[model samples]
Structure formats: C-alpha cells, structure tokens
Target: MRFLCILVVLFVGLKAFSQDSVSVPSIDTTQHTKDTLTIIGVGDIMMGTNFPEDKLPPNDGDFLLKDVESVLKSADVTFGNLEGTLLDSGGIPKKCNDPKVCYAFRTPARYVKNLINAGFDMMSLANNHAGDMGDEGRKSSMATLESAGIVHAGQMSQKTAIFEKEGIRYGLAAFAPNSNCVPLNDLQGAVQIVKELADTCDIVIVSFHGGAEGAQYQNVPRTNEIFHGENRGDVYKFSHTLIDAGADIIFGHGPHVTRAVEVYNNRFIAYSLGNFCTYRGISVNGVNGLAPIIKVFTDKQGNFFKAEITPTYQTYATGVRIDMQKQVIKKIQELTKKDFPESKTQIDDNGLITYLAQ
Candidate 1:
C-alpha cells in the first residue's frame, strides 16, 4: 500500500509539471494592419431634367446607371457633383432670359434613390445649377439628400460635411462661384474653414466648381477664369492653397471636360473629372462626354499613394457607360504631361496612376 501511494504521487507531480512546461505561441499584432482607404470621385451628375417629362431618361430611370454601378460601388467612398435640384416639378424656374446662354436642371425628388443606389456616399451641391428653382428648390434638394442618407456640402450656411468610416473621420468642404454656396473667390475664408476641419478630422477633401465651362475649357489655365462676366476662382492657386492649408485631396469640376491630374506634396488634385452623367439641357459631344471615375488610394493620414482613372462616357438620352476606347484616359494623360511637365505623377495607358521614381 505504501509503494502504490508513492507511485500515485509521482504520477500527479509529473502530469502537473508537463502541463506547466507547455509553451504557447506569441501573437503578431502588427500583421493585422488596416487596409488603405479608397475614394472614388466623379464630375457632374444629372439624372434627368424633370421639369418636362420628355426630358427624362427612358425606362422611367430604370437603366440610369446600369453599366457603371459596380464601378461606383467598389470604393470605400464615392462622390460626385449634384448638378441640379431634387424637387417636385412646379416650382418657379430660375429665369434664364437667354436659353442659349443659360440652363436649369430640376430632377424629381423621387429619383434621389437612384443616386443612393449608385453608391454615392456624398455630393457637392456647390455648382451653378443647384439653385435652378431658387432657395425653395435648394432646400428641398437638401432635405431629399438628407432623407436618403447622402451627405452634401457647398452651401454657405452648410459649408462643411463631416462623417466617419472605418475609424477615420473625414471632412468635406465645397466652394463655387455661385449664390447660396461657399464662394470660391474667398481664398482666405476657404483656407480658414479647411484648416479648422483638418484640425478635427483625419482626412480633409476640398471640392471647387471653378474655371470655365465647355469643351474649349479643357486646359488648366493656372489663372482666374472668367465666364459670362463672372470671375471664376483661379483653380490652380485654389488647389495649391487648399493643400497648403491641410486638404488631402482637391477635386475641381466646372469645366465639363477632364483636365490634368497633379500630385503636389503627396496630395492628389484632379483639376476636372468632367461630365459624368447628364440627361438633357447639357451637351455630351467630344470631350464634353468624357466622364472619368477617379479612384484614389490613401494612407490613414490621407496622403495619396496612388490613383486609377476609369474612363466613362454618356450617350444621348442614355446614362453613363464605361468607355473602352480609352479616349478619356489618353486625353487626361496628355493634359497632365502638358500642364505639369515637371509633375512626378505618371498615368499609364492602362489608366494606372503612380509616382515616378525620384
């Protein structure tokens, strides 16, 4: 009995020693790094001019974004310029004394779902046509977007839009040379607003609807552009100044054509993304129809690492479609090279954007 007792004690001690000696592997927390955020941006979008039923797109807007929905959805955030008001028909239209020189776009409020379905996270309501039906129209449009859970900025009263995604906060401010919107000409005011937003957010994006319009206005003039006796802000100075003031990305649209892409101090600037989708009252011929979906990749701090350009176009009466001809891509490449000859950014034939070797 004594021998059996001593043997049991020895066995228990050995089992306890074996369990205590077992080693567990250490976890590598660094290997689980977060992914870089992707932002996709486009130019003006007008689903259809709803004032007249004939101006609306075919199929009751069922096929408005059939082809490019996937492209827009692939990014973490998608944005565009809301070129018109979302209001019910019947509001007094802004007087366009000369139809040839002026145009107004009013989309039905019900169609706001289309923008939401297209995966647009935000929009810049700072363009000339946002007030097509005046203040009532603008307010209705804002309410519609709010109801649809879409963020918007550009109005002087609501100059900044703040949101968060994936633990990083984003600030968006829009400026344009128009009434009821943040004035693009007020560089100091714009800078102050951007700086304040930057101080609070992890990323800041500044959008401006400046420069001239139409196909002839494709080039970035680097000076103040004048259209119809109105002083459009100097886009080149505005972009650079905003970046210096703490904006990570600058998206410029007003010229209904794609312009150069520049990288200034690790920040990306798309001078003009061009007209993405327009139903009626707008022309979509030649370069005017070239719509580019600019995909931007940035670090947590909002420093641009690379970008991609997917060329798209709008057909008469139809919505946006991907352009296989690569005309828009080639045009932007040419413009970037011509406009910023010393730019370190490179746009390849495949629409891939990367920084050239130092």
Candidate 2:
C-alpha cells in the first residue's frame, strides 16, 4: 500500500505584529494514513548570535542543523523555541542592569532558511531574548519566520498561531514571563486563548518559556519559581491548567535544562526540552546540552498515543547532532519518574514512551 505525504505551504503571520495576526479557522476532522499523527518538538534554539559580535555556528551556520534534519522532518509537524532575534543588523539592544552579565542574541536574518531546511513548521518567540534588539528585532524575527512560511506564537502582538498540515488544523498558543510576550503568569488569559483554538482547531500545541534557569533548577518545583528576584511562574500548574483548557501538548523551556515530562488527562506535556542548537551566550555543558527531540504521536482527536525520543545534543563547536549514547532519554526517564511518580506514562531504556493504564 502507498500513502501520500501532504505539506502545507503555510506562510502564516502578520505583516505588522498585532493581536489579530493569524486567525483560527473552523475545526478540521481530517485524518491521514494512520490513526496516530506525529508532532516533533525541541527546546530553545538560538543558532548563533551576532549581537555582541559574530558568533555563528561552524562554517558560517550552513551545517548547523543538517545532521538532525531527517529525524526532525519525520513528523507531521515540527516545532522549536526561537531563542533570539533574527536580523542581519541594527536594532536597539535592551538595557541590562549589568552589562558585564548581559547577552543579546541577534542572528543573521538569512539563517532563517536553516530552520526551514531543518523542517521547523513552527517556533516559540516568548523567551527572555525575544526583545534583545527591541521592537526592530522582534519585527525582524516575525518577518523572517513568515518568509520561511513557519508559524510562530507567544509575542503579545501575535499571541496564537494557527496553521494546517496534512489535513489537520493545528493551533499554537505561546506564553512567557518576559516583556512583550503573552504573560505566562495570567492563567485565565492562556486558558481563553487555548480554548479559542480548541474550539476551532483539531490540535492545540502550547509553547511556554517559563520556569527558573540553570542546572540546579532542573527539577519541577510545582510552585511559583523565583529566579534572581524574577517570578518564573509555576510551570507545573500552568501545564496542567492549559491541558485542561484544551491544550493537546505543552512544550516548556527557559530553564536551559531538560526537565521531566508528564501525561495529564491523556495529553502530552514536556516540562522543558532544554537547549537544542544554542551556539553561544550560554553553556551546553552536561545537562544543558541534553536536547531531546520529542516525537509525539497523538490520535486523530489529539489524544495521547505512544511517543519516541530521539536523543540529540549540541555544543559551541559542533551544533546539533544525534546522541549515540541516548543521554537525553536516560536523563528524561530519571527526571520523569522522580518528578511525576503517579504519571501513567513510562519511558523505556530504548527511548520508547508509552501510556500505561492504572
């Protein structure tokens, strides 16, 4: 038997960032060749910043994500966290309290093609660096993604992203505790946005850049996280509430470390995916480099199905590559069991994620 693979050339975004960027369409009840639909998601991806100077990936950023392209494209939809602004040049960098510790990310605009080549269907622009270059940087990043035909959400100007792929309509509502982004602290606001998407789209995938930072904060505190005098919001409550409000999958990041995953009400929630292709401005040492490419298989109605983990990692020199040791899988398994002891999902040593009924 043969099956056709449909690709939606969805160049969806707003010319001018606003609250009404991409509108949600009517519900689509279409299904493809199989009962399960694959949605691949990864953590923060900065590629390389040009802010405080040129720090592009090896060979000027051409071979950044090539090694993992095949795995990324294997899903019906692919997503990542766009950690910084995409612009060739000029923009007002945000003022930092201490310039000694501040880092601004401004990747070359041309590098957007790298994401397209890597099969990134969507991205989350709700991280701390979203306003690195101020308004100009944000606009450039939005326009860059639009030109690449990739959907992005999380910015206040573009709260939710709606696109169709393989006959299934997908909705993405992103949030963060940063400025210019849809505030993650507002639970009702997120619920409202996700509910709207759920009312219209077949699958609603939520992206959030919350939780505290660093390796020490790897564990889910299950309460409002405070880091350096900043309230990072309670990711535990946020994920569960959004899932209850119609979010099919919630991909969390911002801690710069891989966190536990939970299966709530038959929906998938990866607490944090960690750094994927971060070249500079942050450390990829140890757990920080654990980039788990999560391929979530969901039923036609977005109900949770078996998933797989393609463990991958990156460094300042090598970019993203498949991890032969499956370090990410091992780490996730350990973290998940420790954090969500009652979770119905079990991950095997071989990286297969299955739902177990009580």
Candidate 3:
C-alpha cells in the first residue's frame, strides 16, 4: 500500500511540474526577427513623345523598359520621376516663344500600362515638364496614374501620397521649383509636411526635382543652383533638412546627370539619378547618358542596411539598357568622394554600398 501511495504522489508531482512548464510562456523569437524592406528609385522617365508621332519610339512603347523591367520588379517599391504628362490628345501645348530651346513631352494615356508592366509603384510629378500642357494635362496624368493604381505626389495641392504594402505604411512627398507642384524654396513648409508624413506612416520618402541641368551639373553644389536664370533649390540643404525632419530616403533628380550618394543621419540620399529613359527631345551623351537604378534596404524603422546601384545607359532615341561596365556606379563613387569626403557610405567597383562604423 505504502509503495503504491508513493508512486501516485510522484506521478502527481511530475504531472503538476509538466503543466507548470507548459503554462509558462515560451520566448517568441519570431517577433524579434528583423523586418526589412527594399526600395528602388530611378530618375526621369519619359517613355515616348506624343506631340509628334515621329517622336514616338519604334515599338509603340512596348520595348521601352524591357531591359530593366525585371530589376525594377524585384523590389518592395519601385519609383521614378514621371517627367511628362500622360494625355492621349486634345490639350493645348505650352506656348514657347523660342522654338529652339523649348521642349514638351506628352505620353499617351495607353502607355500607363507599360509603366505598370515595368513594376512602378510610385512616381514624382514635380518636374518642369509636368505643366507642359497646363492643368488639363496634369489632370489627365493624375487620372491615368490613379486608374493604374500607382501612387503619385508633387502637386502643390497634393503634397503627400500615402501607401501600404506588406502591412507597412509609406509616405512620399516630392518638391520642385516649378509651378503647380510643391515648392522647393519653401524649406519650412516642406519640412513640416515631411514631419506630418513621418508621424502618420512607418516610412517617409522625400523626392525633389531641383539643381542645375546638363553634364556640367554632375556635381552637387552646396548652395542654391541656378540654371537658365531659375533658382533651383539648394539641394544639399534641402536633403539634409528633410532627413532631420524624419525622412528615411531622399531621391533627387532634374539635373540630367548622376550625382553623389550620401548617408546623412543614417538615411540614404541620391542627389541625382540622371535621365533613366528619355525617348526624345533630351540629350543622351557623355555623363548625361548614365542612368542609375538605386536599390536600398532598410529595417522596419527605416534604418539603412545597405544599397546597390545597377548602372544603365540611354542613347539617343533608345530606352534604358543595363551598362556592363558599371559606369554610373563608378561616376557616383567619384562624385561622392569629391562632394562628401567624410561620408560614411562606401561604394565598391561592383556597385555594392555599405556604411562604416560610426
């Protein structure tokens, strides 16, 4: 009897201990795993010109982005500066007194599908060309992008575009010196908008189409740049201020050439991506031809982890093609070194980017 009672007590004690162990919460390692996201950005993209049929590309815009489509698709978000309006027809063109200097770009509304196929999730409509055809053109462009489910921002009235992917919310705001878009000169206003976006979303991306134009403008000037008597924003000041205002990434374009990449306060900034795919009415020579697609990886809170630059080139009347020599990466490296000698970001010959220990 005594032996049987002892066995029962031992079994009861073991059972209680097993229940207690099971009731204790197990460490949830899954919740602690790092969450990351990838964002890719490119510069000006005008698939084809619609003002004159002859200006359009050969394949009805079919092959415009074929070469870089897959690379663009491989990101959580792909963005570009939609340098022109999307209108099928019927809008009065902007009056330009100088026929030699004035150029306008209008892409057919049907070509929006090509952008979708290219895997573009967002765009900036703040370039000088956005108003080439007036408010009607801008309205048509906005409608077309909306129908295609692509998020866009840059208009003065609509300064921010918020989107969500994979349960993460992202906010984007674009600034430019042109009319009908968020003014790049209003630094205080721009910072306020960015701060509001940062408060509302998990990540905030600030884009600006500022700085001088052409190959001579390859270097980032610390002061306000003036091209053709227009005051392009002080890009160095603008980018750093936006980062201070809580922007995770800053993508700058409008200078028709690639510029330096800097890490300011642990955020990534590409001063200029150059002309990615401008089919007509744009120069594509020397440094102007260099196109870069920058891919950035960041943690859930938008801390930069690493980056990669896939160099591309665009010749006259041709779309963007991958550069085997990685010329754009090399150019960026040189400019980064010259413009920001104390930068923590490192760019290798192979286009890989890393940060040094603080």
> Which candidate wins on TM-score?
2
The lDDT of each candidate is 0.82, 0.85, 0.83
How far residue 311's Cα lies from its native spot in candidate 2, in Å, is: 0.8
User: Alpha carbon lDDT of residue 161, candidate 1?
Assistant: 77
- Pairing residues by index, what is the TM-score of model 2? 0.92
What's the lDDT for residue 219 in model 1? 88
Off by over 4 Å in 2: 1-33
lDDT of 2 by residue, 305-353 (tens): 8889999988776789999999999999999999999888899987899
* Candidate 3 per-residue lDDT over residues 156-243, each given as its tens digit: 6556776656556677899999888889999999999899878766778889999999888889889999877789989999999999
Residue pairs in collision within model 3: none
Query: Tens digits of per-residue lDDT for model 1 on 226-268?
Result: 9888898899999999999999988889988899999998999
Task: Write the candidate numbers in order of decreasing lDDT.
Answer: 2, 3, 1
**How high a TM-score does candidate 3 get?**
0.89
Clashes of each: 0, 0, 0
Output the TM-score of candidate 1: 0.89
lDDT of 2 at 11: 30
Compared with the true structure, the alpha-carbon lDDT of candidate 3 equals: 0.83
User: Cα-based RMSD of the predictions, in order?
Assistant: 14.9, 4.2, 13.7
TM-scores for all predictions: 0.89, 0.92, 0.89
